[model samples]
Target chain A: MIDIKNKIKEYLTKKDTKFNSIFEINKMSGGSSNEIWIIKYLDNNTENKIVFRRHYSRISEKENLYPPLSLSIESEVMAVAYKQKIPVPKIIYNVDKDHELGESFFMEFIDGITLGNKIVENRSVKLLKPNLASQCGEILGKIHSIPYQNIKDLNTSTGIDEMRKYKNIYQDYSLNIPVFNLSFKWLEKNIPPVTNKCLVHGDYRNGNIVVSSSIGIKSILDWELLHLGDRHEDLAWICVNSWRFGKIKLPVGGFGLRNDFYNAYEQSSKKKLNKESLKFWEILGTLKWGIMCLKMYDAYKSGYDRSVDRAAIGRRSSETEIDLLRLIDNEDRYE
Target chain B: MNNPPSKEELITSVIEFIENDIIDELVGQKRFHAHVAKNSLQIILRQLKLEEKNNRFEKNRLKEILKMDKDLNELNKILCQKIDYEEIDINNNDLIDHLFKTTMEKLSIDQPNYSAYLDEKTN
Candidate 1:
């Protein structure tokens, strides 16, 4: 790779003169929007483990055009959410422009499985399945309860804005996805009323968090799309078909019942949830994720990144399309 | 174009080789990469075996529903444009049926193991 260890060591030495050596730096796989390296360094005969997250510069122009937020913004959001009793990685250090590794930050590495399939797979993390769904709802409640006024200036998005944005992304790919159009039409005709505004974790799915088989959700990761929007969006997103990891019958993250999830949210936030709005955002989240798959395809087709992961993800758009058909035909709601 | 080893046979052989040879020796990241390679080969096989039949089925359905003959891509583009302009008869059974069947057909190759695909197939 780029020998990032030397740069990290140099930067650490400046922050503290004792950090004179790097013990080991392992590049964690499954990197997408950012380059994540789990690093071990020695400072004053003491060893420390930290996750080094830095922006990947070689992303295609289309993917970069959206989401103008910086890593510092993510750090700030994490800090805010942590204060509100949300389980999140501790912000070790927020990198400034003076550091040579470009825009990056450090967080205390939390140990847990993050793979969606393993999170609820029978042979894997099946122990976590019993309590994860309700625990997920409670976590989202804590996040959504964070006051809108506190984080509104963070360049976030609202429901209508997100709808328009999803449309741009869908059309931007230049692929003929008729199912997307059908969903878009339905969303256009059925825009739910903006009852209130709150902090919405734009990507609150199974793979986006760290979960232990015993403790449930340890850290809610991936706040790159953290925004001020419908609180229901966060609740609905975890229920998307792909997020369920094949336990399609269980609507809430493929483990627990939806009724239990709703009860947990109502208990934690102490607020009555608007079910209709939740359904609206659920549809929106499905459409957005579907478009995200196509975005990966576009990235690969245009000679940006040629990872097999991207190519495989490109084929998953049909999964979203099938999910959309299920949703639009009203079978999803009954299930 | 039919050679000694047919396209399907070659694809299957390559996939089996990757699964038995390279994948077993790999660990961690290399193992994951090998898994991806295996899936990719399987996807290619699926596309080769099913794409023609799927395309013909879709084209026939589109022709019957829209009452016109056009290239497959062109027909799909037309359907999307019609939806964009709100000209689609959303409640029509024929249109929804076409969408459902086409999606399931694609998933039969794309992700036959996907839960929804199995659920639909069961029904």
Candidate 2:
């Protein structure tokens, strides 16, 4: 178990939280890019629970895991987003080397299904589907409203910079994929001029959202990719088909219409959205996901995280290729 | 080696074991990984059964489009290079059709149930 419990004790003492002992430590698994565990401890005869996430030792620094961000930065971003009233898991503490734990942190555990299919298909959650689009827009408006100068150490970028960064990663792999190259050609030519740069929740999608039957979007998790970028990146990523969970017709996270989502954003943020830029970002988001799939495949082939799931995910790059083709060619569903 | 238990026979038996026995026995997160493994094996089985036919079809299409003869992998590499350098116009009807057909064939092996694939296939 890597004696994670002992490390937790040290962390509690360092933060002056006054830990009694660990009640239980249960490992959690989802679309996790880190080692996540639910640690229940008793403090002054009272029970408490927190989610502890840390970098796994097996993870290589050399790995082309998406643009790397330190866990401290991730924690800070979470704090900033929470302060801005953006629905997020409240970060409790950032574990540093002084605590003798690897890069890790303590966070409030929000109970809800972040699984896309569960949110789409489950009868309990499906009742809240109609309200989800506007809720997403409202949360995104607040997240983007966080003044850019407040969050420290954020990489500022436009849509073109993102495209080039991802393209460079593709080239570094020395991987020549014709379809992806075609996407690069198209996105390079269509880079929109940036009218606004704000705090972008780089991975705001259906699967990243936490939902309950009564309270929709309890939290938006996974802030490791937080950056300053085109507002449309967050706007278009939710509409990506993979996040829609087989509801191809329902564009906004498989919950509502694009117009409804856009209207909700305008109502909340008072910013007019660019339809052309939105389309460009949708294409770019699809391309980025496709390339990430290829990277996972490479990780498996190179014997790095040799999980069977990674191998299956590698095959899934084709899904993004199809999405790109549909978007780029203006091919409507079933046509 | 000529064997009585063919590749398909071995694959079928293993798949049957996973589907009938293992799936029923497994639960929780392990069950999800089990499903993924089974699906991957099934994809391998399909590739084994279809590679000969698909490769021949793919190579023939490339030959027609590129106006030269080459192996399937080599032809694909060249096509990628052509697309990379803009040597071949991307809007060419043959190129689009070929790319679409290629991606669909891959999804048939990789994820046949993908919604986009189902929609494109039926159309």
Candidate 3:
């Protein structure tokens, strides 16, 4: 096993001129397949912290429902977003050529609450909750408005293409989920026409953001899902019931109403929000989450990640099933 | 025959042990994982208590909607294929009602406290 701690220390010393030595290296819980470490180092006799996120090969690509964007793509998107004055972490280092460290990047860690339950519960930042919807809208507006030529490397996948991708992954599991079949059938029949594709922050929910009481969203983390897609994909994903964290009444990431979010997004992006597209993407997003849960279960079943957490997450597909039924139900249960 | 402590009782004992004894003793990641373990066991207990009744209702619903008889797994698999092939209309009232009720029963076992499930239950 490579001594990752020593490699990180050596890399920091080589990259940062003022770097002295490491103080502490703690691992933070990251995505299911990624490893994130908090590196506290002594730079010019000052203690500083940075996050080192590395995508590990613990789970292979075949196990995942959606393959994550490459770490280089993630770093590039973060750099571009930062340049555009979007609320995102600053990329300190992009390690592409390094063969040993593998696919990873070092970023300046922004401190705030990134927990979905805490954000939705409105415990610490009661004032920040109401304004979060608009802040997200504004951020997403800026993200979607990013010029196509700037992020030319991002492969654009349309809504139908995305639906087909998830459906293919679902079939790969070969598990018969009636609700999932209904959702796929409904999405196939009601798939929205391909709109103008832009930089879509594929996962832009409350959990992926760092929020403070003072500054609403300090930085947007987790750009692994970044892709070129319809702007409504970003907008509707936040409204998915799974991200609401039990605060389903408040649809916009369980923070504020959709009207505020749409108005703010409209003001920022100068694009009218389409209700039909948003609704379609919302259902699609829910089904995607459900399939993702099944993927987690597959990981456990396949013995790639045999943790209790993953096993329990398999049961969570039912949550998305109820949410999907609610969304597709013509009685307007989504209201 | 198995003795005084039934399967549900055994699970309840473990959950109480975790809640009252083990969880507080541990900190940080260990405690968090202990909670997850307890929750997983609770889910199993809920499934044990509810699966038979839920399956019976689900099978009855499937029989009514599909107008045919089969075992639960076979019927569910058939329902999925029928939905896939567009044999049953997505907007059919009986189908929708069946899906809704089945999902609710599932949530009762999987996550009883889920917000949408609770909302639907109260409604």
Candidate 4:
């Protein structure tokens, strides 16, 4: 504990001379990979709330396949997305890794349901359920339409490159998961042409968004995996069965049908949606998530982060195994 | 031998204690971890009851698919190499069937309530 309160106080006072005192600093339930804290402070006798998010430097390069986006770059991307009228948190100020506060930034806090299980199944949020899928499709369209040139240091690894990358990681694990091998084989044979490459929110799914019952989606969270890839990667990633959170039949993040989602996306993006490419990316996304789960298990076995949550996530790889089988065995149905 | 509380009973008691006594008393990340701990114990209980039969079925399937008698892990390793080297047809129905059944077995031990597993089970 680096005395986060005092550090924040120093930063705030320097940024704005009128900074009076800190009121409260509450740690929020953030992504497993980062730390999020909601800070309330008074500047000139007026109270304000902002969210502080920081990347955990403790995550060794050996433990993660791709390092998360630097906070400076993330701040830039958030600014770009905000300009494009996308639902993203407004960046307040960003500091580099060399800062005593580490690689972290403060942003406006948009409150809503960020839990996957609750957004999909909670009765209290039932009012937003009907339009959730379309809203997601529209947001994804907006995300994909952002020009990639402005973003700096974003890797533009297309589907084939990503497949090889993940394959290398899986092989490094030295675990003989035949389903993963078969899925790789399937992906190789059915790799789609990269027709469009744009800004891809690499982990856009149910849990990554803040959803309000009144306005539907308030803001999209977790841009650490930001990259440039096939537009369908964002579209298909949300449809992956693992993200569905037990509502398998309703494939659009377990909220609505694919048609509604696709129509809304097409309308917003003004680009034709290819069902075949979407199916291919969906399979790849499932495999990627499965490999990620195994990575979690590897972390546990190697005593990296021995939390029960990481250990439990390791068992989830099997869920994706069965999902991969279903997608391959019954391609017609899933597509 | 431990007569009063067997391994399964002891695990069940711990799970009960965590779920009924410990979980609700906690909040935020601690509560989340407590739930994860409870689920982990439940998975152990399921594996204790199901692993032997599941492994037997999986081994038999792998043997049929690869036409070899070997330990489960060894057979799986060979199958993986075959797929990797393109020695075996990727779309072979036997391979597909075997993978599906083996995955289902693993899911039963891991997360039986997972939607994909539940969908297949109901189907």
What are the per-residue Cα lDDT tens digits for candidate 1 across A1-335?
55578888777778776556667888775345677888787756778778888887466556653644578877888888888889999898888966667788988888888888777774434455547777877888898887656543576577788899889877866779788888888888878877567777778887898877776789999887777777788888988888888888888777667887888888888878887777778888888888888887777777776777777888888888888888878745434
lDDT tens per residue, model 3, A240-260: 989988888889888778888
Which model is ahead, 1 or 3, in terms of lDDT? 3
Of 1 and 3, the candidate ranking higher by TM-score = 3
Per-residue lDDT tens digits of candidate 4, residues A60-137? Answer: 887876866677777788889999999999998887778899978989978788889888886655556448888888
Q: Give the number of the best model, judged by DockQ.
A: 3
Clashes of each: 0, 0, 0, 0
Model 3: residues >4 Å from true position, as ranges? A43-46, A331-335
CA lDDT, every model vs. true structure: 0.80, 0.81, 0.86, 0.86
Q: Chain B TM-score of all predictions, in order?
A: 0.92, 0.91, 0.95, 0.96
With a 3 Å backbone cut-off (N, CA, C), the pairs that clash in candidate 1 are: none
Instruction: State the lDDT of candidate 2 residue by residue for B12-102, as single tens digits.
Output: 8888888998987989877887888889889999899777887788889999999999788788889888987889987788888888888
| Candidate 2 DockQ vs. native | 0.78
Pairs in steric clash, model 3: none
TM-score of 2: 0.92
RMSD of each: 2.6, 2.6, 1.8, 2.2
Candidate 1 steric clashes:
0
Ranking by DockQ: 3, 4, 1, 2
**Better by DockQ, candidate 3 or 1:** 3
Candidate 1, B70-117: lDDT as tens digits? 999999998888888867777678889999999999998888898888
lDDT of 3 by residue, B22-110 (tens): 99999988898899999999999999989999999999999998889999999999999999999999999999999999999999999
Query: Considering summed lDDT, which 10 consecutive residues are worst modelled in model 2 chain A?
Result: A59-68
TM-scores of all candidate predictions against the true structure:
0.92, 0.92, 0.95, 0.94
